[model samples]
Target: MRIMAFDYGTKRIGVAVTDPLQIIATGLDTVHPLQIIDFLKRYMQTEQVERFVVGEPKQMDNTPSQSAMHVKGFVNLLKKTFPAIPVEMMDERFTSKMASATIAQSGMGKKARQNKELVDNISAVILLQSWMDRKIY
Candidate 1:
């Protein structure tokens, strides 16, 4: 089974997944907020998801960011819809900026770097990788 991560935003939700061995995280896709459940349902039909990691937006003061309020419903829905799968939250500060910098350093053209969907997808990947890096043993 693989672990999945979500970088949730009001308009779009980014998706990423780790391999069954949980060594590497890969960008999966970006889907509309309303479609996340359906998307996961379809994805789970083919892939066995072991757990979910969600990006929790935070402010400089270490308090929950305004966007965190918006993510509550999405988190609730995930737990409700997939009761068996566990959910985790990881700090997501600067992930978008990191993804942008990664895209820039990748030699991607300006137009491709400007794609919000791609940014979101990469942000999810970064979030998942960061979480994995924090794991012990």
Candidate 2:
């Protein structure tokens, strides 16, 4: 089954999706918090997403940060928007750092690292891939 993943930020949300077999995850796009609900409403209608895996932000000490509250709110929005799909949260402590390292290793220009949306999108892909790797047998 296909799964949708989200990296929720204060201003923008990164999105990713797994294939129907849940083997590979791909970065989709980053949307403004204000537009996320509408965007997902349309996306879910077209894409065959069976579930949602939202990244749960926590500090290096494993303490929940204030950002987690915003993520919870977004999770509520996802539940209201796609009531049929089950939503789960996976710890996203180091996704941003991992994404940055991945991008730098790819030899992307510094300008790309400055792009919050791009970074967040790749972070979402990492988050989804981690979730799939951990949860899939």
Candidate 3:
């Protein structure tokens, strides 16, 4: 079984998946918000997903961020749609900045680094990896 992660946004949702061994998290793709459920359904047909890790936005002092309400709504929909799969939330503060730094260090082209979708995908990877690390140690 594999684990999946999502960085939910109004326009696009970043997706990531763990290796079968649950060791490494890789960026999967960015899907439109409207298509996330359908995309997951189609993906699940081929891959056995064990759990869903969703990025939860929080304020610096630990209060829910403005975007947290939207994420909570999406999490509700995810639980409703995939009752068998457990859902988890991981704090997502600074993930976007981390992703941007990662992209810069990778020496990706300026245009690619500037792509919001790419940032989202990397952020999802960061979020999933953080969760996996926490679980391991």
Better of 1 and 3 by lDDT: 3
Q: Count the backbone clashes (under 3 Å) in each candidate.
A: 0, 0, 0
Could you tell me which 10 consecutive residues in candidate 1 have the lowest summed lDDT?
128-137
Q: Tens-digit lDDT track for model 3 on 1-137?
A: 99999999999899999999998999999999899999999999999999999999999999999999999999999999999999999999999999999999999988878899999999999999999999988
Deviation from native of the Cα of residue 134 in model 1, angstroms: 0.8
How many collisions between residues are there in candidate 3?
0
Choose the strongest candidate by lDDT. Answer: 3
lDDT of 3 at 58: 96
Candidate 3 minimal-lDDT segment of 10 residues = 105-114
Predicted model with the maximum TM-score? 3
- Which runs in model 3 stand beyond 4 Å of their true positions? none
Pick by TM-score: 1 or 3, better one: 3
Arranged by TM-score with the best first, the candidates are 3, 1, 2
Give the Cα-based TM-score of candidate 1 against the true structure.
0.97
Question: Residue 106 CA error for candidate 3 (Å)?
Answer: 0.3
lDDT of 1 by residue, 36-90 (tens): 9999999999999999999999998999999998888888999999999999999
Error of 3 at 25 (Å): 0.5
